[model samples]
Structures are given as C-alpha cells and as structure tokens.
Target: MDRVIYNFDSLSQRQSAATVPLRRSIYRARRVPEPRIGIIYNPRSHRNKGQDLACAGADNAMVAQPRTRDEIAHALAGFAREGIDFLIINGGDGTVRDVLTMGQAVFADRWPAIAVLPKGKTNALNVDLGAPADWSLEAALKAYASGRRILRRPLAVSRVDEDDPAMLGFIFGAGAFTLGIEAGQEAHSLGFFNSLAVGATGAWGVLQALFGTNGNKWRRGTQMDLRYLPGGAPLPRSKYGDPARRSVMLASTLERMPMGIQLFGAPRSGLKVAVLDRPRRRLLAALPAIFMGWRPRWLAEAGFHQLDADAVAIDVAEPVILDGEAFPAGRYRIEQGPELTFISV
Candidate 1:
C-alpha cells in the first residue's frame, strides 16, 4: 500500500483551523476533554483493499495491527487500565461487533467511546451511525480531527443461548437467506467485491427459494415460536392490535434501521424495537407493505408491545443468522446493553 505523511506540525495547524467553531460548541455543551483513542485495524480485512487504503493514509492517525477479538479486548483492557478515554475501531461490521462485545466483558462502564472507520464489505452498523457509506480512513480522520460533537445512539445485543455471550449487531431469519450467506464464505478468496457479489447471490438464493422451481423447502415452511417480551409481559395475540406479533423483518435497536428504512419513526428514548412479520395472506397484501415508499399507518395503529425487560428472547427450531453469520440451530434471545459510542460525520 502507498503511504502518505503529513507533518505533525502542519496537521496540528490544519486541525486548529478547522475546529474553531466546533470547539466553541463543545464548550457550550460542557467542558470537553481530549479523548485517548484506541484503534483496532484488521490487516487482512476486505481482501486487504481496506487495509492498503488505511496504510496509505497512516499519517492521518491510526494504530495498525492484525489483532483478533481476544487480542483487541486485552489491548482495550490495558488501555482502560492506563485510563484511556475513547476507542476508534477501523474495520468492518464484524470487527466493530467484536470490540463492542469485548468492551462489555472488560469495562464495567463499557470501556471508552467508539468511532468507526467503515472498512468492511457491509458496514451496516457504521451506516446506522450516520458514517458515510463511501468513507475512507483519511476522510474519517479529517472529521475526527475537526473535533465535532459525535452523534451517539444505543445498540441491541442478542444471545443464541444462556451460556453463549451476547452479539453486538443485527440478526436475521428466513430459510435460504441464511443458507446462502453460509455458502458465500467459501468464495472469500474472490476479494472484497467478491463478498458483495456473494451477498447478492445469497439474496438471489432467497428469491429462488421463495418462487423458483426449487421452492419446496421454503414452501413447506418451518415452524418456530416468536415471543415478544413487551415491557416484560407476554404481548396478547390480537389479530391486528399488536404490531410486534407480525413478522416480516424483526429488528430491535437504538440506532437507525438499514437501507434508510425506518421500521418505526425515530425512537425517542430507551430502545426502539420493530418487528416485521409476514402474515399468511396473499402476496399482494405483503408486496405493498414491502415496497410502499410511505410509512404504513397500520404500523402505528398496530402499537408494538414494549419488551419491558432489558432483553427479549427468540426460540427457533432452526439455526438463525445474526448479522449474516450462521450459528448452531436453537433458541435465541435479544436484549439491550451498555452504549458503545461512535463518531459521526
């Protein structure tokens, strides 16, 4: 990877020039302190394209390493031991999830604040945090150096079993959709774009499972029990009164929904959870709901039952995908956890 070096003195002058207004805003909010950043970069991430780009932009300020989850957690634990104030993770979604999970395990107060540099195939979490979809490390650093106030939102954590540790990102279900992702891993050698092509192929597989000649498995349907722990009470099953009961695309989060889709309008406080369940009806009724540009009033009228508890559990007869990764089939649960902060531009 090509490397570029910006003299520290010049960089400092540039930052001072850019942050004048932002610094004033910070002072008004309250006394702001310099954040000690712990960076985790995946040397082998995204076919090494992201890594090469990041390496080229090293002068922008980064800590480069080929650390895994355990290594990163230990490093962060060391930083916490030394009193670091924040963390900046530069990798893909899996890297972000690992750091968040490790933070939960290490710091009682949730380690340091986090900022992500989108360097992965699917930076879903970063997108939710308002980071630019096409962001490069250099661009991210400029925004960081400008000392702007970072917009932060909470995150939802899920666990496959009681004994299993919680997951820090999204989760999904639906037959071939899950299987196709599993199959795509075999073609990782094709590189970063390959991963995306693999994902597109996976989606195609899902469509084929739903409509093509090879649709027997999906058509047969698998039975699974989905329970909502709304404010700790089992949501009463009403035909249309409770929205959470319906299952089209179930997502619970304190962050924005992906693909610019707002399952529910922006949530105000606590966790914002939305469940999209497909009713056993004609495809026409579902097609409109899926493709309609406007917010469906039915979603609002069909009030969602609040899962009062910090976490909600999901039981499945088959293996489910959490952020596109397949796990052993069985019961699973979802819940909220400590806030992992992020810097947004």
Candidate 2:
C-alpha cells in the first residue's frame, strides 16, 4: 500500500530548529498536474452502508474514514499539510459539522474548495449547497475541473463567555426547532430519510404545537435573550405581547432549505433569522406564508418575525442545535464565517 506524504517546509522553517523534524515530500520539487483530492468518507452513513466506492479506494485518491473527532482533525491536518486542493466530504451534515469545527484551526481562515455527497440521514447542507441528491464523486470532480462552482459561507458558532474555539456549520436552530430535530432523528430510526423524514418530522411537530397545551414541551418553548450585532440591541417581545419565550428560531446563510420551507424569507445572502414567538392568535393563519417565503407586513404583527442581521448573540436557556448536533446552554454567537468555493456540478 502507498503511504501519503506531507510537506511542512514552509512552517518548519519558521519554527525553532529543535521542534521540527525532517520531512520529505514529492511536492518539494515537482507539483502534481491535477489538483490533489482528499475525501473524508463515513462508512456508517445511512446511504453508504454495504456500498463499494472504488473511486475513493483508488491508490491516488486520499480517503480517510476517521472514527473519532480527533482522527478527523488529524486527517484534515494531513490533507492541509499535503496541500490538497479539493475536499470531498462524503457523509451527512454531522460529518460536515465535524469538518468545519475541527478543520477551522487547521486551515485558519481559508478553506480548500469543497464538495459534498448527500449520503447521510439528513443532508440539509447538501441541498443548501445546490447539490442534487444523486450527486456523485465522479460528477463533482468533473464539474470542478470544468470550473462549475459557487460560493457559500458557513455559520461560525462560538461561546461568547468561554474561550472555546468557534464551530463552523450551516443551519443553527433553537427552542422548538431543537425538539423538531430530535424528532427527525427518531424518524430516521424508523427507516425514513431525505424528504420523507423531513415531512414526517414536520407533521409531528405541527401536531405537537397545535393540539398540545402551553405546558407541552413543544408548545411551551424556551426562554432566550437575543442581542443583534453591531449595536447589540436586545430583541423586543413579540407583537402578540408574548414574553421572551420563543416557540422556534432558525438562522442560516444557506439560501435553500429542505421541503422548500423558507424559515428566513427570500433567502438572500448574509445572516437571516426567523423567530416564532409563543403560538398566539392567527398562528395557524400564518403557517402558509411562513413556509412559502412570503414576507407580508402583517407577519411580524402576528408573532412571526424575520430580520436581517450582521451577527446575533444569543443567551440560550436550553440546549441549542447546529446542523444536527446539540450543545449545552450558554452564551453563543452565530455569524457568517469565511466564504468558500464549492463545486456546483
């Protein structure tokens, strides 16, 4: 078996002599004609089970199925050190989250061009990136070679008070939204996936929020304080006169969402947020407009609010979910990270 080699001449020269080790790389003298490619495949992904990926297994292709977060970080570090040009994340949203969070420090601000294959239980990131469900590694590479690509910025989430490094991903949600994701995971275990799982989850969420009483976990919502960026102004109570409790809230830089549901209207660039205050009068009346991407003036007055923001600082009273993973209650800031190029083909 051929072993991968890394070149660290640039950084080793800057570090003290005692700390650096002797490293040899073919790249030291000659550059490869093709853009070096690295793939991080997750064998446990729902779609990858029992499948043979010969392209990924090729000797020239650098593929690593890291079993742990530390292994993932190590794999990304090696890819960066080897100067790979294209990174193909062949798994679900969780894999993408791990890459962005773990690879943030490895790549610094700049990231190599990336492509994703929607092979997970939930692939909202792939949909947002405009990659079709059938997109394959071969097609993505061909597209990159032909200059078919687009730019997107991952949401950088960081603890405001603690010194923990920021985590990068798309789709940050809280309150009932977090509970909905938990339901989605349940749907996954029932053999539902893709659009079916999303629809099933949505239907279940609606039932919980509708017939259930205020004491219901889904309807009671979570108490959270929000401070919009720049001026750090606090978000006011909903026009329905509801308190600081929010039924659901979602934030993202992605322009598209699963099932064509647009939480943040029109979906232009920058950070957009949609918050549904405690279900009030006309809550059912606003459902169509809310999911259809309509930004009617009456929507805000009815307790459904959408706003544009440069960044948002949130003090979450309960756990928050980003992509598909949950985090503890804390003061966190979620804003746009560096814009990255991605293969559209």
Candidate 3:
C-alpha cells in the first residue's frame, strides 16, 4: 500500500511529470482555469501499464498511491480539502468503489466530478461509462482534453450495518453467482485469463458444486425481501426463490461486458436497470443468454423485474457482493445514490 499525493497549478505542470508518449497530444489542448484534479491509483493494480499511460496523458492531475483502504480515504479527503473540481480514478472496479466511498464523505457537496480509467480485471463500471477498455493514461487525458463532456447518472450505495458506511455504485446479490466472483479472483491470481476468464471459470465451478455431493450444503437458500420504493409494486414472497432471483449480474452502464458480449439488452438499454434472474435454472439459463440474448426473456418471465428506478433495496440473510467487494454476512440494503459523471472518448 503506497500513497502519493500532489496538487499542480496547471495541466502543463501535470504533463511535465507524465511518462507516457501520448501525453504530448493532450498537452496541446486548451487549459481550463485551475481545475483542481485528484487522481487515485492502485499501485498493485494489474493494469499498471495502462494506468501509467493514462496518467501521462492528463493535465494538472494529482496522483495518489494509497496503500490501504483507509489511506485511500484519507487521500481523497485531502483532495476534497484542496477543492478538487474533478477526480479521475485510474484503476478497476474495486478501486473505483473505494474512491467513491471516500468521496461521499470528503466531497459531499457534489463537487469533484469523477472520470474513470478501466485498469482492472473486471471494469464493469468503466464499460458502463463507455470509457475505452484498453485505456492508457495518455488516451484518458486525451479524451478529457478533447472537450469530451461527462455524463452523470445515479449510483447505488449499500451497507450492512450502522458502523459501516454504504458502498458507492452497483448492486448486491448472493447465491452461486456471487460466490463465483470469489472463486474467479482465486483463479485470476493463479495465472488464469484475467478477470473475465476467472469469472467464466468461477461460474463453471459454481455449477459443478451445485450438482456435486456438497451441492446440498448451500441448498438451504437464504431469503431476500425486495421492495421497490416510490410506489412500485412489491414482489410476492416465494418459498423456493430462484438462486438467479437472489442474484443480479448487471452493469449499470451502456457498454458491453468485458468478454465483448451484451449481457444486458441493447445499448439504448443503458438508461434502465438490467436484472437477470432464474434461481431454478441457474447458470444453465444464463449461458445461452450470453451468446444468444435469449435467456434474459426467461428471467423476466420468472418475475425478474427491470425497473428504471434510481434506487433499490436488497434485504437478505446472507452477505452479498456489491460491485466486487464482499460485505458482512447478514441482511443489507442497497439504494441508488448520485450519478457519477464522466468524460468519454
């Protein structure tokens, strides 16, 4: 856990410290007035090369290398103190979540807009923002310098207890699917095909475990009470809730999944919340939908609702993974927060 923090007076000052070759391109753009920019990067992040390149491309970007989760929060607090106008996060989903969580506390006044550089195994949030999957620091800076506008949408935040603050952006889910993410991280560390490959393998492992002798271990499924607020209908409680019903594999953005597949519906479907469910069918049903776009319909038929609400709540007996971070094993509530605005290329 390393933390580096800097405050530059101008984009030209930032360009001077950039190490990427593409920084020159972004340096030529018009400079905005003292736009205090704060950047958080994970030193141990997998995509260091891309992050380095993106850092080199930005102007007047203050870089922080936070070693621990709390350190990252402190660095964000410093940025807020400096009155940062924009925050460019240069890591994967986990890093983004950490920064957003810190931002809510340090920059609660709706200042410091966020821009993302997807440099992680599963960049679901980056993909949603339409940022380049292969984003280098230089490319990211270029996009910002080229006058690209940032889009703000609501974010889903959640927490398990009063002592813990809510997580920023994304949903919570349990069952085999959530467990698969854990397995995928292990496979990824063991030299697998990165996050996407790890996810695929993890899903397979879940399937195998479900049918194996130990399958009965997790058979005592927990209960999930979902309530749609603002006058939406309440879902009827069912005894055997489909594992898929308890699970949600959704990307809040309009982009495709990392595997180049459209897990949600269409690009236009970006504005709406996409929910895929079917506990009874499990991955057996989701596999076909990934390749053929046919399974989501079945999931919808099984009472999986896809609402455009900015907020939602999930109360469960077991712990749920929001984005990629795991919370305590107990009931939790998730609701949509403010929308993160980004400048896309």
Full-model lDDT for every candidate: 0.49, 0.75, 0.54
Q: For this target, which candidate reaches the highest TM-score against the unseen true structure? A: 2
Candidate order by TM-score, decreasing, is: 2, 3, 1
- lDDT per residue for candidate 1 within 1-345, as digits (tens), equals 101211112322222221211111221121124545556777655634543444454442336364655566556666666555546677776676666655555554434556677766666666566777666655654555554444443344444434444556543443444544555554443543323644455445445445644234433334445555654454333354123323332444534544544444543344444433333333324333443244444543343222333555556555555555555555566656554445567
Clashing pairs in 2: none
Cα error, candidate 3, residue 185 (Å): 1.5
For model 3, the stretches where C-alpha displacement exceeds 4 angstroms are: 1-34, 49-60, 152-154, 160-164, 193-195, 202-206, 209-220, 230-233, 236-256, 260-264, 267-278, 281-287, 290-292, 295-299, 303-307
State the lDDT at 282 in candidate 2: 63
Candidate number with greatest lDDT: 2
Q: Where does model 2 exceed 4 Å of error? A: 1-33, 56-59
Give per-residue CA lDDT, model 2, range 18-84, as digits (tens).
Answer: 1223233321112235878889988877799899764832356688998766677778888878888
lDDT of 3 by residue, 1-345 (tens): 111221112322222232122211211112355567788888766777433434554557778988656677667767766767767787777787767765655555354556787777777766656666776666655565564665544355444444455566543446554556666667666766443664576466546545655234333344555555545455433234454244443335434555545444444432345443434455444554543455455455553444554444556565556566655455444455554557677
Q: Which ten residues in a row have the lowest lDDT in candidate 1?
A: 1-10
